[model samples]
Target chain A: MASEVKFEKVDFYYGAFKAIDSLQLTILARKVSAFIGPSGCGKSTVLRMVNRTNELVAERTRLEGRVLIADENIYDGVDLFSLRKKVGMVFQRPNPFPKTVYENIAWAPRIHGVKRTDELDEIVEKSLKRAALWDQVKNKLKSSALSLSGGQQQRLCIARSIAVNPEVLLMDEPTSALDPRATARIEDLVEELKADYTIVIVTHSMQQAARISDSTAFFLSEGAGRPGRLIEFGETERVFTNPSSRLTEKYITGRFG
Target chain B: MTRARVFDLSAKAVAWAVAISTMVFLILIIGYVVIRGVPSIASVGLEFFTTAPRGIKMQGGVYPMIVSSIYLTVLSLVIAFPIGLGAAIYLAEYAGRGRFVELIRFSADLLSGVPSIVFGLFGLAFFVYFLKMGYSVLAGALTVFLMVLPTLVRTSEQAIKAVPRSYREASLALGASKWQTIRRVVLPSAAPGILTGVILAMGRAFGETAAVLFTAGSVPQTPASPLDGGRTLTVHLFYLATQGQIEDSFRVAAVLLFVVLGFNLTAGWMMARFRRRFG
Candidate 1:
């Protein structure tokens, strides 16, 4: 449902120190884009700027340039709440609400005024199925979401995001906390979800980016106390196999982060 | 082997001694109160609660004082809950690292640390003399409201903050407005902790004597309205004890203890229920 997203000469700072510097990138519609970088290289910060979640940070922080969704500037006087609904996010750690499984899925729809119980039930089931979690939790919909295993909780978080029918789904290392099997399942789900929605994932795993992403961006910390900078961006195959920059080759070949 | 056995035995003995002593101290206080207060209850029987105070005689009841105490507690809670909760929400959710938040938090801490007698003086100077409210139930309720407001604000703020950050993010991602997220997700999750604070505030308001005495004027007769003067159960006990009506004072003290005990037990039960529901 999400159209292409474009970041044009965007710069971000926290106090005197910059976190992201003059970054330019485009995330094609209905494709999975992955940002791979070393620790503290502003990958997550870049991901957060897409939906304006970074605005929740202290007011002293600054942003420049623009992030556009479907050719409309998301940063220009748009109502942030509506922008967030269109651009949903899932964190690295699965943080489920302290509520029942059914209520977790139903929360978004209910907030948006989907008061009909039957419609809510359908949305919950379909979203769970899409997130690949319906079978494991169908019988225990009323159980507390915290009771789910780590992998299931992450999927439930995905279901929670999908239930709102967002156009874009942003993930910040969504599989980092998961085990191999769970991570594989989530990768499969992401591949399936790309048919319908635009997804931008920030991952530390180069293999994960190669496997699940259509495009990949590499970032590196410039120097001590300096903001991280974007190094290279291209198709996933080209970036991993035949990158335009030596830093991308060094990172993919396991020389260094 | 002998040294190890001796050390283990001494450690176990010390642990048992500490645990038993703590329990014994608690039991001793309860035992003393019951032993001294039971006889007074037996002397007056049900009249200790059912009949009106009869001029320093043990033959009368604590009906007016009991009713007045309940009235004041309810009124204070009604006034404090909304204001305290609103201030808490503003501090925890909206005021993020601002000067106004720091100022409010500092003032609330200062208010909590102020002694009850100081609050009584403020009530007297502000509500009684300045406002010309003059020794009424309204003055008593207002004084108790001030005494409990800081507790409610601090506790509710902690409770609201304890809600997970993910809940807010998930709610907002669903297109819910900021206030809607607070109402639907944050408040419901924090309800138990907020209720616990309210109950504690009620216990303090019910037992207060110094603040109420200065503002409420300790009228022994039943209050006809909020504007009328009244004496709460603690005030009645203070008067009888000071007036040297030892038997009557003991009766009133026993009744007050019973009421406090009943409230505490109910609050404990409610807390357990909330924990089971949400925790």
Candidate 2:
């Protein structure tokens, strides 16, 4: 169910300000690619582009060049709804809908035209099981999602997104707002999920990137109000231990960022 | 006592005095109306509510006026709700923040600020005369719709905007279209606030007098259809008070107050229920 993501000569702008500049990369299928960088390095911006969710920002924005998924150029002719159906997202914060746990998981599938009650029930159960939230929530599917703790709420959001069966899952600092235990749980979930879904995560935690990701991409900007560039990209082990770029080595050594 | 403590005590006393006096004044006004109205209704019994006027329009009941008021209020709300909600949704969700959106918002604010008498004149010239609907419930309802539209749209817009943007993002990320996101998530979350606006607008429509008087006429009869001219309760009461039919006017005032109070209470109850579910 997973697909490779390719970016070629990509340039992104918010209004007239260049955000990400002249980037080219390939994210392989069924692997977790972690984008580790300091704040405002345009990592989240790159993650959002896969689903074209960046267009939801109120300001004027433009994306130049091609982003391909499964060998299809998504920007050329793909339907926005279907593109988003194939690429789901989880945010920095837990944002479950103000609905029942069952309804939250069932919502996306219902929108994608899964109408039968029995089918919805199955999806809810399966998605919750996949997200490791079934045992805690199965007894109270009718209860509001807000009743769940912050960590459980984040998992619920994951379950809700995956219920529609997307090929790729984009996480924008999904564990940043969580506690250590919650963050660890999400990391483990990612490891399990990468077997089926192509996962891309943006994180401030370098250790998390080293611990879970297969390949890691490091992005950096020269200063404030400047465009972000990909500093380095390679297997996580080599990137952390024997990085090719001096800046990546300096950052990984905790000397400067 | 210390100067700071003295100032704090005086401020507390002033706030308490203001709050108590406002409550006292409201109760006094309502009590006065009830005293004058209830005894008269008690004397007349069921005939006061069921029968039509007799003997120079002061002898029997206000059944026709009550019927007209309900008809005009219901019709106006039915007409205004969808249009106002649509405009509100466009402003809050779809419309880009720009000069045009600001101009639209300014126009709505200006419309709500215009006096009721001016609205009455416009209703007379537009709905009653130009449109050739005559003095009827349809004309009155149309006039009331125009009068209450700004309030409905403004309140609904605030409610819709209050829904967290994250909810929209979460819905859209799952591949729901903009319309699907709005219907399933945005609208349901905004329902309680929108309902409050509608009920408040309903009270405004029901209590409206000058506009309805101009468009609906002062015919003392139950309307057979929306096209039929009729007298609303406020118009009947105005006529009664000016004609020295003090007893009937007080009774009409009492009924009007109770209905508006009922609307406010219902809004409160519904808001509590929605909050419980949504939270």
Candidate 3:
């Protein structure tokens, strides 16, 4: 599989404090890759860097080295608007705008200049169906997105993301705030989505990484006052059953993360 | 009773006494004004609202002042809203975190704190003399614009900042430009707050006397255009009282007080409605 996203010795800093150092990784196209680590291990940072979402972090945060999406370096004069259009993000919390469900999905397309009502209606329905939420919310398309339950809201966020029709979807602990049923539904959706879209997920759940990811990358915090590095990367089964690094082995076996 | 209990009882009594005194004083002033003002209002009756002030002879009417006050307020707000809102959006959403932003915020605060009389002088010097607007309603509207800009910018900035960060991130992630995000999401979310600030500013513009005294001269007849001299309620009231037309002055005071009261009630009702819908 061709590499869809690449990080080349990327060093990220929050003011004087370095969070990610000398990180090298490749996410394959149309596959689910999971980044798992203990807290503050820079897994989420790595995920956000793909689309330059970290640019919105506190003013002091600075990212050095190259982050490439497909073949182009995202940092080197890339049009941020188009780059974001091609790469969508689902945050930890399901942040639906204070708008109707239909508006939540249609807003992205509208801003991108999709004006015809019928066309927007079609896109909204299709996106919701793909996210497996159409059946539940088909009748209440005009209702406020906040009125949905936590699980449904998460799904609605996914639908909103897909509505923009991005090639890559970044999920930052998307199911962490969801119940088991909602989590399972999202996992199923992820499995279905990877056939066409490159999906990079940051998950804390070891089993979730094991069950859903095609490949897994293990990250470990280098004590205090040091940045996190990619310790090991390999096929999910191999990493779980027979890891290469001692830290990876220790992490999977739950010895001392 | 114990010492602690006695102390607590005394504290409660003091608080009650303070609160009641405030209410009592407020009622006393309004009661005296209402008692003195009503007979003049009744005697003048409909003519109070229908005819222009009869100056020097002190005929009883404030029709010109009422029209002038309304024009100044509406025109000033119309001109000030966009400029103030734009500055606020820059401070809240676009400006980087640095001393530059700090300087701008500090400047706005300082301007707001400056006495309105100083602003009147500024209007007199800059607009009336330099710009040669020449003591017209336009000059007065411009003066009030400066007077109200700080409040508008500060409150609108707060409103914009209060919009959750997630909305901005979500909008940006969806390929919307920063300008687009602000126009579509941030502005709509901050609408109620902006409107409330505007209403309060309108009230301030209506009640202002010093700022308009030089810029908007107290013309006897009603103003016909922005270039014409106009007198607001406060200016007319000042003229009436200072010239010893106490009864006419009371009628003007009653009118000013009720108009300000209406503005406050409308603002309060709007904010309450906004909170219920958004919260």
Best-fitting candidate, scored by lDDT: 2
For model 1, residues A1-257, the per-residue Cα lDDT tens digits are 77789999999988877899999999998999999988888898899888887766545677889889999998888988778778888988898887899998998878777899999999999999999999999999988888889899999999998888888999999999999999999999999999989999999888899999999999988666788889999899999889999888888899886
Residue runs of model 1 more than 4 Å from their true location after superposition: B1-22, B39-44, B96-101, B245-248
| Candidate 2, CAPRI quality class derived from DockQ | medium
How many clashes (backbone N, Cα, C below 3 Å) per candidate? 0, 0, 0
Judged by whole-model lDDT over C-alpha atoms, candidate 2 comes out at: 0.93
Can you list the residue pairs that collide in candidate 3? none
Worst 10 residues of 1 chain B by lDDT: B53-62
Pairs clashing within candidate 1: none
Given the true complex, what DockQ would model 1 score? 0.47
TM-score of chain B of each: 0.91, 0.97, 0.93
Give me the runs in candidate 2 sitting further than 4 Å from their true place: none
Error of 3 at A70 (Å): 3.5
- Model 3 earns a TM-score of 0.89
Residue-by-residue lDDT tens digits, candidate 3, A28-67: 9999999999988989989988888787776677888998
Q: Of the pair 1 and 2, which is ahead by DockQ?
A: 2
Ranking by lDDT: 2, 3, 1
Runs of candidate 3 exceeding 4 Å displacement: A1-3, A8-18, A58-66, A178-185, B1-47, B54-60
Residue A76 local lDDT, model 2: 91
